[model samples]
Target: MRGEGGTRRIVVIGGGIAGLATAALLARDGHSVDLVEARDAFGGRAGTWEQDGFRFDTGPSWYLMPDVFERFFGLLGTSAAAELDLRQLDPAYRVFFEPDSGPSGGTGSPPAPPSAAHAERDPIDISAQTATNVERFEAVEPGAGRALERYLASARDTYDVALRRFLYTSFTSISPFLHADVVRRAHRLVPLLLGSLERFVARRFREPRLRQILGYPAVFLGSSPDRAPSLYHLMSAMDLTGGVLYPQGGFGHLMDVLVRLARENGVRLHAHTAATEILTETDRGHRGRGRGRRARTTGVRVRDQTPGGGSERVLPADVLVSTADLHHSETTLLPRELQTYPESWWDRRTSGPGGVLVMLGVRGSLPELAHHSLFFTRDWPANFAAIAGGTVPDPASAYVCRPSATDASVAPAGHENLFILVPVPADPGLGHGGTDGGGDPAIESIAEAAIEQVSQWAGVPDLTERIVVRRTVGPADFAEDLGAWRGGILGPAHTLAQSAFFRAGNASKRVAGLYYAGAGTLPGIGLPMCLISAELVQQRLREALR
Candidate 1:
């Protein structure tokens, strides 16, 4: 229902998936929406880069949570199928674990021995069907297939509880959580909430590779298996049973569809327009609770390059939603008095792992690689420890996406589109990226090591030689380009305290009519969560405006 004011002037900051989704939904609610994207193009992290007739998805390659996409598109009076040419990947993804060393330690130095599956140099493909995956699990360890069924059963239950009572509603108040349904299930959920995902999987599976496969999904939430809450075991159910889908063109194609939907819904889109300030006015005697100062957002001050010089303008807004980095929006755009999640508060918080993204357009095919593949280091804890301590792992766990195997449009014929992601510490000091084989030495080294690791793991020895085009985006690029806090590729880690309501609230306690949406303030990380974050913002707007 439209409030007494009827149509409101809303300014949405950032043009990422969250921002685009927010603007589209708000405009549909009879609000006058103006979306400002700092970049020349919309899709912030979820963008595309084209070079020499080859295209690469800049971020978020995997498409899980079809229901979230379905609901998001449905609200816009359309469907995922209508907007995208979607296909379910047959083998969801392949897992490549660290190689086995001989029993006698005849070669190089190492701390620990390889696990049972370490002898299996060949990568294992996790199938879309549960039954097939069960067979695969049985191949790894005795009586483990049944363990997978039990684990997934629990995961599905958790997913159900989250979808019905937890995932959609933002924890703006204690009221939403105090519901009878939630209280009834609190007993069943409390243990899950308190436990860690690593423990959750370890209790079920014995094989190291199986544990890595089940626990690695926490990375999608920008968290480690040991740090993420057990409730997130639901991530397993997302791909293992529900399956993975690729929007035919690419993730960028989905972004284009969102931009089109936003325009169709009467949103005035302004690309290359950066929000300079979050204009606010004092609103005295504020009642209910966030940081204590009380002010209402009047609008947003924006800057855009003009023909002669940079021009500044104010987009008057009755309501303002920032889909930009929460830390950037609060610290850079607002005064200290009005800022929530100030730097001091962020001091104790954990930003997620930074990333080294290697996009390579390689000649010839990569049949050994699946559409999606993960190379897990045998020493998982040591790898994460290295990342946490701001040290680079020599043999790091990496993810590779070969979109060209599925989408011809991403690469030129006879060439493969290879995108690699290596999680590093969130350190801006690592420096930015470079084209070809040149970049900041620190950043380039990570990319170089990642490429070499992929070549060795996938048995593509000439991978580097076959590369026709290459680009690298490091932690510094994330910070400089997106104003990401700590140069984190995603946002805050989804540790126990940082999950759901315990995570940052979407609205400002210090400012009224001001809200935030994205991975930083959220239902949690991943593309699905970003879409859900927009919905949570709407829920806030609906009640606050009404």
Candidate 2:
């Protein structure tokens, strides 16, 4: 609500969630803001596809971390409850443990499963109510009901600490962690920061299925539970305790709201406009030897996408914030000498998992599927290994979102809508997806396998027969369309070193007035994190202006 400094010309590249949020915030702060998108429409990966009365949300299905959403909206002088229809899902999501999932072969010795690992049972529903979820846990493992309560209680403490002392800290300086409140609690965080989430969950629960439920949330953070620091177990409190929810109209509606917020705040949004290069000039005021090397961005070169006849021209800017992939924005847009994060720097980085997104318009009902369902293979470690190693595991762990189960607008009278995500290695060589399941044979194969896997596990025998429409997206599309690094679908993987203060910062190290926002920057992945990244840019700009 406050314009901290005098107005300046701000150019924001990429009209994705982060970009829109950034533009809105900066514009509200009395700046002349312009946002450009390479694609004809906005939303980037958080896009929508419609066909024959079926509407599919291509990305970001689950709405978790409500507090973060409210905070972002609050910053815009609005409220989430006032601006959108939000619902908390009871039986938050269903989980289907693969029937033959007990044997762990590839990833060395996993904790031995409790007896009855594959007992025949209905797909389990994790309820919004903690007690209901406790009963479900107790049904399989005796005494686990009490254990669930204890685990969640611990998760709540960690989540609270993270929200106050970590997540929102911005890491712009070390002072955040050095605060008295943070230092007083620092001793409690040592073990959590040192261990892996997988080990953290295993010590609390013995049941493989229960462990899977607790550990799987790491994927939401774009990491394997075993690889992510145990500090991430805070995610369990969000889904298991805080509960999952959905916007009444899907993330596309959220996109509409973002655009509205940006426009109302004076951000000029440019559709089908792509930034080709970042223009820079030597600082005339710098009376030193390194004057040429100490140049600042003057503007950006934008390409006019007017079909057969268009060229590039500069869009002036006093400051630049790129919500485009940081790797591309730094390596491709900026000159080599001016690049803050050069191509060689990325060569040493690891990308998060790429995804095969399948949007299916099924002709019949899917009573077995929930608004959110997770089909987890027992040998998840092996599947995780295959994905990290660039091999599509035959029995892969995947997710299914059947929004029609809650919102009828997504599908026709008698039909159902399904969005499937199968995480794979971030390799564009996997090729691209196509309409009606007719993509590169490799991409389509992944879709087919995922469909069959869901059918068998969810007990929907005729799943494939009911699919009347299908569309898929592979890693290559993420690379070409979103400029994702290494075709990774969810920015950089949140590995230990790549997390927290170690992740990409919001400001350009080389270009004084240049900044970056989005999943690729600090605070890490997800819609909420990217929103926070935009706020971090605001914070950085304020510091510079002051």
How well does each candidate superpose onto the true structure, as a TM-score?
0.95, 0.95
Q: lDDT of model 1 at residue 324?
A: 97
For lDDT, the strongest prediction is 1
Candidate 1 displacement at residue 343 in angstroms: 0.7
Candidate 2, residues 1-546: lDDT per residue as tens digits?
123457789999999899999999988888889999988888987999999999899889888888888999999999999888988887799988777644552233354444454462357898998888889889877888999888888788888877877777567668778877768767867778788998988787766778888888889878898888888887878887768988988999899999999999999999879899998887665566552346787899999885763777789888989999999998899888888778898888878899999999998788888899998876777889898888988788899999998888888999999999999999999999999878999999999999999988888898888889999999999999889998888988888878888887777766768888899888889998888888888887777777
Clashing pairs in model 1? 290-509
lDDT of 1 at 321: 97
Candidate models: Cα lDDT each: 0.87, 0.85
Candidate 2 regions with alpha-carbon error over 4 angstroms: 1-5, 104-121, 284-293
Give the per-residue lDDT of model 1 (tens digit) for 305-327. Answer: 44454789888888999999999
Clashing pairs in 2: none
Report residue 88 deviation for candidate 2 (angstroms): 1.7
